[model samples]
Target: MTRILLALLLILGFAAPAAAAGDQGWWNKDWSYRKQVTIDSSPSGINATGVIGRTVVLVRLHSGNFTFTDAMPNGADIRFVDTDNKTPLPFHIEHYDSTVGIATAWVAVPNLNGGEKHSIWLYFGAKTAPVAQDEKGTYDPDYMAVYHFGEGPGTASNDSTANANIAKSAPPGVDDAGIIGRAARFPGQGEVQIAESASLAMPAAAPFSFTAWVKPAQLAGTQAIFARGGLTIGLNAGVLFVSGPGVSLQGKAPVKQGDWNAIAFTTDGKEGHLYVNGLEQATGPAALGAIAGPATLGGAAGQPFTGELDEVRLSKTARPAAMIQAMADAEGKGGKLVTVTETAEKQSSGGGVFFFVLSKLEGVDEIVVGVCLILTAISAFVMYNRFAYFAKCTKGNAAFMRQFRRMDGELVPSAEIPGLDKKEARLIKTSPLAHIYDVGIEEFNRRKARLGNRPLSSQAIESMRAAASEVVVHENHKLDQWMVILTIAISGGPFIGLLGTVMGVMNTFGGVAMAGDVNVNAIAPGIAAALLATISGLFCAIPSLFGYNYLNSQVIPLASDMGIFIDQLLARIAETQAEEAADNAMGGFGDDDMAMMEMDDSF
Candidate 1:
């Protein structure tokens, strides 16, 4: 015991290096420096040289610039060295940013740290240049960090920008990202600080402000970042908190996903401001008392952020948009390049609003709908006209039969426009009175030969005389072509109307289902469909049915009359034939020569 006590006393007396020496700074990060750095330069950048650390080293600077502007790189940074390969690191590199005119890049440093030093490089998109370049040689890569922002591909959020219900958990298309849903996100990953709540707590809430370079995936969550009953960002339901209360002065400044935006939400408990890329997107009206909520890194109480968020920052004072962008720019420096996925797109944070705005796009959708309607209407009109045309043709045919039957001229031309055989036409040309003959002259000759001038006064003459007793046959066939359209009118009109009604009813039912209740709103659409279709059907059918019967009635009587007229003409001609024969015989008829000749024809 005495030996132990003596040893303890000696050790206490000797004193030891402060055990908490390495745990005092920010993140107590792996770094080498005496105390801390204090940087303040005008129109010039700040840097930290002689500082040592393992592997990846970060040089943070707070600039008053906006989105990486209002400042330039100066000579205060430590020079990286490739102690092994005797080569530079900036040999193969690229840089990126979204400034007006800035461009910077980096190369690989295969010499130092197994090429860790020159893996990536970055800079502002414009005006960002390498710290220095060897005029005689390529960039040295001894001091480079692998940049991994905007390196991947971009994606699309919507195909036509008109989807009201965008799909979630889908492949984000190029140049677009995010979808519409409740708390929807994309490429989702993060650790839960606290399961029930964002179960993480800030060690000290003394002076805390939050900022992140992000591209929102969606604007559908009730809250983007909500803790307890307080702090929340994003389009929280219909509310937004730049950096203050959960519900203060709500504005309508929404952010689009898939684009690079440096957002900062800083509060001094009294005044809070929301900055985007070094400019204010909006301002908070609620004076924050203490951000009395547990610190949330990337999402609501329990939901992880669903989009790409880079360069997370938390400070005691509010960061200007410019400063945040500078941090991003600095990250894009020669090494350890920081980047936002200008190419990557998360889900949208505002799908409904976006579409709502788009729906209001002037004359776009309306014009499309109008064109569709015009096409439909034209189709309907053509169908209706066709139906009417069928009736008109049928009626006109009947009228032609009546007019022809009443004429005194011989019924030489039949309504059945006979297909003329060239041979028949030639034979008709040989017969002078071809107009009066239904049969070709060859046919007439053939018939006469069978009788052979033998006896016009015999049974053959009786046969002809019997037929002349009637004109119209009253036994016609082959008359159905013009009836089809009328039949269609009778049957199709009602069904077409019914179809419209059915579709309208279906629409109404759908509306009811969507609204979760049956009401007048739901019923109106169905009724409209029903009424319109029914009306259209009636429009099609009525005339068709009427014209069908009218044409048939007019045609039947006229056709019968035409048959009677033909019968009367045949009978009269036969009687006159006998008389003419008698007269000729009385005038100069004899027995031998003339009689023989006459006999030949008569037989």
Candidate 2:
């Protein structure tokens, strides 16, 4: 029994690792750092290196003076894919703040996991939209404006988006060691300013979003990260402060100086929301008015930003919570990864019910189910065998009883029965009723021999009854063989299943502890796997229980038949002896009787 269980568990062990691996193929993952693809405003097609196992690629473009408008720049055609595969990989634009004469562009090239080095073709010209989708068809963000100040020792930084809004520096500018790419640094007096445009201004009632990645050198009186017309996102006294017309709200939490923090502010015409590091820190009711002035970064209204600011984004629409977190997640801040695979979602949404859940079962669960299957097979075999054997015994007993009833209490040799084939004779020899008849006949014959043809004594009749009853006991024992196996199946199946379920739960908690992930995704699979065990246990037990009840019902009647036949045989023997004794006491008178008396006739 132990060995069979071990074999079942072994078969189950392989299932989980394989299923886990198969699940991986449904998603885009293993996002290791790949080669950087370089971009420039000029049409000279440059080459970039690539690596293996990285499905997502980051492209850094260094265009010194040109501005990236909402549309792609003219004479720029940046085309790339795996050279061997020869398909255009999906791409998205990531935004960063600008510095003088030195701007940066971030493009994500996804699904490039092939190991072979691929040739990338690049030329600046008419281009398609930077929007791209994961395998699930969810679109990656396409920023309207992106400025990355990565150019070393340059006077003017370029705008990355097609919208031509470049920043010009007043004095000493770029800082090389930035939080991400190089950042534009400002002294108390220097400022980087973009000329006024309709894109730079926000509507009075329209939804708006603003986000910035900043590392503050000083958090004293007030320092503006970005200030435009009426809206300003700044730091004062170690706390983020957002101020607009009739709206002045400070973040509930404080941040330490020199640490990178993501701060955001969003307003949807009726309410304003503030965030620190991807978490909403404050909210208030409001309607923000439009801003008329040009946008200023690093320093605004004479209060200059002292430290590094890397990525800053301003959109005309308020972003959802998931998108807000995605922005932070893209830059390696606190947020969940957006899954590329839609397989799990598709399975759940399609509504196949229980079979779908069964497919998702874990290793221990599969093992428990297998054991239950074995038990079920054994139970079915036992029930079928018992039913067939009992039916045969019942038919044979009926046939023998029919022949015995027709005999009219006449004792005859077995060979004298008419038309009996060898097969029929063999069946009678093995039948329970026939065995009882043979036992009674043998006992009577032995007593008759001992008493010398006299009427049998009362003590001898009692002894024959005891001998016949003993044969019935032996037949009852034969009927009970292998019934205990059915009992074990009924009782033991559920307990084994419970053990598997408990082990599965333990494994689930252990995995959660090791990974430090306690979300629904982490918890659900384990719990589902655990419950499969109980399902299997019930599968094994229910059929066995029913089968045992049915078979036992048949056995009881056969036992009763044996007892009834024994009693009738003993009574007939007693009655025959009494009649013979009465006749002898009366004295014989007829000739045939006188001849029979001389020959010593007996019962």
lDDT by candidate, in order shown: 0.36, 0.59
Q: Model 2 lDDT vs. the true structure?
A: 0.59
TM-score of each predicted structure versus truth = 0.30, 0.48
Q: Which candidate number has the best lDDT?
A: 2
Q: What is the per-residue lDDT of model 1 for residues 1-603, given as tens digits with 9 covering 90 to 100?
A: 222221221221332223232323222121121112112112233222221122222232211011132224332121222332123333221222323212232222232211122222122222333354321133121211111222233321211111111212222222221110011133544321222222123222333356555566665654354233355655443234543333254444665555545556665545566655544555654455444343343455445455654434344444333344444333332212222111111121222222221122122222322332333334345445544543453454344434334534223333332444564444433321222223222232344458442224456544553443221221232233335656665676667656655655555455334322233322443344344445445555665567666656745654554445444444434454455556666667666867788889998
lDDT of 2 by residue, 1-603 (tens): 432443333333332321222222122221111112322112221111222122232333321112223124431233333333244454433333322112222333443322222334222223453434222211233333555565565566556555656776532567665645567676665667777775566667777777777888787878887787867788887688888774677898676688778788887877888888767788997588766677787778866778777666666667555345444543432112311111122211232224334544456667777778788778888898889878878877877776776766446544456667787776676578888888887787677667644676778877887898899898888788778877887898888889888987877666544332344544565666677687667767888899999998999999998888888877766666566556766654788878787788653
RMSD of each: 27.1, 16.9
lDDT of 1 at 143: 15
Show where candidate 1 strays beyond 4 Å: 1-291, 295-481, 515-518, 580-603
Q: Report the error of model 2 at residue 599, Å.
A: 22
Superposition-based RMSD of candidate 1 using all C-alpha atoms, in angstroms: 27.1
